[model samples]
Target: MDIETCLDSRIIHIKSDIELIDVKGQFISLAAPIRLTGQLRLTDDLRQILACIDNEVEKLTLQIGVDEAGRGPLLGSVNVAAAILPSAWSGLIEMQTLVNTPLSILTDSKQLSEKKRDKLYPLVQQNALGYVVAEIPAAVIDQINILQATMLGMRLCTEALLVAVAEQIANDTSSTSYNLQAQVLFDGNRCPELDYLKLSSFGISESSIDCQAWVKGDARHTSIAAASILAKVSRDQTMYHLDSLHPQYSIAKHKGYPTRVHMEAIKMYGVLPEHRRSFAPVRRVLENK
Candidate 1:
């Protein structure tokens, strides 16, 4: 039998044989003798193994992940994504494997190429239990500063997703309770204030939801990674559309980042309505002009 190494190092696929390997690299034969002995039959699929692993660890409640893209750009809106993934690690792992995109390869949007992020975008949306992508435009960023704008975007997406999830549960015929327990993870050191959600009309309680700001959570958590991909791809598409309208700015090339080409374009053509006046580079151009 030929051994095949999956893109994810955890999963090893064997060709022409029915043996299964666990994450710990322990091999279990799924052939006749094992079955006759009444030993547990395991599938070659990593999801089954992951399920077993999940059970061994603590079972978590609903997980909500929030992340943003285009926060540092001198132009365009900041896009924030709130995503709810399956609480089980197995289910999260399944999302990537289904698209043939390994978890290790697609851990964070920053580390992924544009092609890979585009490929995973739709798959993430389809798999999410609930999701919301909110944009805070440059005008708003200028009004409240970039940090506040980013926080606002995060808050908006999180609120929208929470409401959507609450509505789904309320409408479910089989569910008896309106109470929901969830863990909200934000991909940064500081999360937006959600204390107001305690008095929300959706019957969601502050005590029931735990919000945390996890530094580099995008790489550590599957739900956050999915959110990052969605936000990145959405922002990229926005830049592409803007580029089509204003080819001189090369928005698509740098996605409105303060590159030499972008700065030169701003200097020659002047600032667009989309440019953030609060940003130093764009502000300097405006001052000089």
Candidate 2:
């Protein structure tokens, strides 16, 4: 993103079309010097120059946004994450910059296909800090219901992200009081009540920002989408493991969902230890068995 500046400290915005060439043929004022180049991608250069436009207003503001996926699904774990991105104050895009890269397709969790999620999982693993993903087993999910399970996962993510961000700042600041400020954002109608765990901050209390939960947050927030991919991949792996542990239940085929095939398997083979007894269908299957 280099800017051509022979005239130092001055910014130039070339808006009008000008023929840049060997201008011996064109009349020029002595005040204006001639400029020529063999090849110049001025437009391309301008894009980098534009990207360099960063917000200088805010200082060290971290926005920890949380979201989850697979909560409604009868299969995978309810995935959640609290992504600590350098707020708009930094002008740094979390995932959109990789438009042409392998992860260019990172977007809303629902918008992402199973295939896309699988592809982005590795990308997330490599990049995110405190990428703590908790797997909510069917037994536990059924015990607490999907909503509770999603909350549990979100709590775990919040705890982990807060710890991680604090540690990062502490290490960077050498234990100095840096006035660390954070705002929590989640893709839900309300804020996450992390009553289940004892949350602590280095010096600051958990500041709850209006989560601004969009209906399609995964598509809206790059951080949420990254969290979705992490949760989806982890849940799939858990399901695969369950398949190995209880092959007769065909956990792999249905991914622990109440599919017709899964129901038939339950009816024929009986429920496994992992089956959620609290869930009505599983309870019915057990009673019949």
Clashes of each: 0, 2
Tens digits of per-residue lDDT for model 1, 1-289: 2323344432222222113312224443321110000001122231222232311332225677889998899999888887765444323433553244333355689988888888888777655555677666787678768887777667656765555445544443243444556778899999887635333567677777788998988877787888898789988888999999999999999999999999999999999998999999999988998
User: How does candidate 2 fare on TM-score?
Assistant: 0.68
Which predicted model would earn the best lDDT?
1
Candidate 2 lDDT trough over 10 residues, lowest sum: 31-40
**TM-scores of the models, in the order given:** 0.73, 0.68
- Model 2 over residues 137-161: C-alpha lDDT tens digits? 5655665577866765576566545
What's the lDDT for residue 248 in model 1?
Answer: 96
Per-residue lDDT, model 2, residue 259, is 83
lDDT of each: 0.66, 0.52
